[model samples]
Target: MSIKALVAHGSTNGSTAQIAERIGEVLREHGLDTEVRPAAQVGDVAPYDVVVIGGAVYAGRWHRDARRFARRNADQLSRKAVWLFSSGPLDASAAQRSIPPVAGARRAMAHLDAVEHRTFGGCLREGAKGRIARSLITSGRGGDFRDFDSVTAWAERIATQSLGARAEPERGDLRT
Candidate 1:
């Protein structure tokens, strides 16, 4: 049977949603049937063989919908091959860019034994954010920081494991 995967994400300003769509597209290219949906729109996991959950980080927290999804689906996810990602961090340096998943996300995934957790560079566009975000950008702390190649590579890695082509190593972090 072909593997069915869900790429669910919580994004404000649409950047993380785009990231999730690209991930779903990549997995589809690799032969997995994929669904890309906003986390709030997803309330069940029974139809999927694996799950990819991603959320945008803001003020050191994941979007509420994503956290809620993780918490609500923790049990089902625990039995499935799961990969989690956080689209945050604007820096390009490997060390500087590697931010851990938010606390709620980490806590929710603790019981799932997820296959991997990845942090990717994020994009911050002018006028896309609210007062504080716009202020931060105006201060030169943000811009388009997402890296497509790295995102694709990580999706390929997930595809590798989800397809059962190779055994995944002990849970690791993909810092892009």
Candidate 2:
């Protein structure tokens, strides 16, 4: 059976969504069937063999949509290979060092038994929605801080791990 992966993210100003899409792309490049969707739009997790969930952080809290998705699909997620990510630091901090998951993401990671969690730099540019986003842009504190290379490296690591592990047959399988 082919492995199917889902990359679902909760992005407020679309930066996190782009990161999620890039992850899906990397997974697909490694031969896994992958789908990228907004967390709120994903109705179920049963179709995927593995799942990668991410959200944009705001004031140290993860996006609500991501939290809801994890809660709603906790049971299914716990049974599968799961990974989590956060994108919210509008600076180089995320790329320079490991940024831990925010409070909500940490809770979900425990509940879902996720294999790993990553934090990526965030982006904010002109025309971004939300007052805070606008303020940050005006205050010269906003820009595209996302590191696509780091994102790609992380996804490649996931593909390598997943592909290697999945190549091994289960204990009970008998071959002629």
lDDT of each: 0.81, 0.90
Candidate 1 residue lDDT tens string, 122-173: 7787887678778778889887778888889999988877765323345332
Runs of candidate 2 exceeding 4 Å displacement: 171-176
| Model 1's TM-score against the true structure | 0.88
Predicted structure with the largest TM-score when compared to the true one = 2
Error of 2 at 153 (Å): 0.7
Q: Which residue segments of model 1 deviate by more than 4 Å?
A: 94-97, 165-176
- TM, every model: 0.88, 0.95
Where does the lowest 10-residue lDDT sum fall in candidate 2?
Answer: 167-176
The per-candidate count of clashes, in order, stands at: 0, 0
